[model samples]
Target: MAGRQTRGRQRIPIQFIESQDDMYATFSKRRLGLYKKASELSTLCGVDIGLIIFSPTGNPYSFFSPGAEAIMERYRNPDQPVSGIPQFIDDHSRTQLVQLNQALDEVLEMKEQIKDREKQLDEADGIRPKGWWEHVPVESLNANQVLTWTTWFENVRTQIRTRKEELRNGAGTSAAPGSTR
Candidate 1:
């Protein structure tokens, strides 16, 4: 007998995922990895890099190093000299905005989860389940219940049989117009 095969990380083809949910999940995971790599590059190389990604759901994501603003300034206007003071101003604002947006998103998600959990608990509270009747093999709990349970079970069986017979008879009548019960 063959043992279970080990399925490690397999490379996925670079192609568009058809499912919307799967696409979003893939985007989030890849985006995170990309950000980490960019961060590592900036730290190790001591170079500035600004990375921007737009999610499939249209959310904007960005990572900026300390030198991000200076780089952007140079890109925008090559002739104009880059200034360190202005770089701090721009980077500070971008940092604050990114932090605020992330915090708000996390708070909203936490609030939503709490609300859903509360609603579920509230609904469950209304059920008020208790007693030996809640257990399976309910007849074991109360000997008196044995007769009642048996009768109830038989009633259900009888109803099912009656319903089946009625359906069969109805179909037979329709199929053969001259037939009468």
Candidate 2:
């Protein structure tokens, strides 16, 4: 611990960064953190994890536990058969993200068909399109629709972070050191 900080650490108050530069900087750092976290969760649970996030500038990023192709595959088309084992990856973030970027792009693309249907739903029927949370682009959604989608995204992010913390704390308390090879 010679190079480590002498002070203890605590979680900071969460708020949106107002400055564009600061926001971008934080986004880059936190994006890396999300990768670290997903890797940790995959290792801890011995399960494959797939995560996709779009940057403040709309660039997409993904993290997958080697087994994410099936996920990206399924996302490309859920009706398409999913066939693979859940294989946890070590540190393959960069390579895996590059390999799956096309699928990520497809998932992010604005669906013209859905856009027209969403209009009809909002104007006439008033029923939110089911599963829009998955890949519906904001360009097709109204302010209220976007707000609801964002709220759901934030809630999901909070839950993922909370679950990661719980797993970390649980492992820390055990002092098992189970990997002493």
Candidate 3:
């Protein structure tokens, strides 16, 4: 009898697969595995399991060991006292609510931090915390005042550029060896 030889499966790296088709295939296989695990867990423990999945294509897939309605009802009313089997649903709901509240608090703190940063920026610019329109009252400024401010800023910018050019030229000339007057 001739000996039979079998090829072993190749090991792939754990990083992201670049190919879209490969990624989609992996997603499908993993989703199936997840469902299988959920089923096995529910069956072995004799407990209700609800699983909801959203695919990359935005399609939703679900599996409920007992029924969707029963799981959802328990989720909706966490505080409602239940005797047998579905108490896990209430615990999950409470956990979710606590996480949601914590997330909300974090968002509010972020908003306040942003406001503080904005106020700091305004102070750095030597401007009031109020909006530009509110502080300046553009309608109140006559054409002369506007023109004067514009001309002043333009002159200031021109002077700054001129000084920078002069300094660059002076540095270059001074740094050169054997330079005459």
Which parts of model 2 have CA positions greater than 4 angstroms off?
Answer: 1-11, 73-181
Q: Please name the candidate that would achieve the greatest TM-score relative to the true structure.
A: 1
Per-residue error (Å), model 3, residue 64: 1.1
Question: Which has the better lDDT: candidate 1, or candidate 3?
Answer: 1
Predicted candidate 1 versus true structure: per-residue lDDT over 1-181, tens digit per residue: 9998856678988998999998997899889999889866865575667888999888899887655656687678979865678866756765765676579879999999999999999998789675444567653457777777778668767866876788887744333432322
Compared with the true structure, all predictions reach lDDT values of 0.74, 0.67, 0.73
lDDT (Cα, tens digit) per residue for candidate 2, span 74-103: 567867543434223333543565557657
Ranking by TM-score: 1, 3, 2
Q: What is every candidate's alpha-carbon RMSD to the true fold?
A: 18.5, 27.9, 22.9
Q: What's the residue-level lDDT of 95 in candidate 1? A: 77
The better candidate by TM-score, 1 or 2, is 1
**For model 3, how does the per-residue alpha-carbon lDDT over 1-181 read when each residue is reduced to its tens digit?**
9888745567778998888898888789889999889866865575668999987778899987666876787688868866555556545654664566579879999999999999998788785355444567767889998898688668767866776787888854332432222
How does candidate 1 fare on TM-score? 0.41
Total backbone clashes of candidate 3, pairs 3 or more residues apart or in separate chains: 0
Return the TM-score for candidate 2, rounded to 2 decimals.
0.36
- Give me the displacement of residue 83 in model 2, in angstroms: 5.7
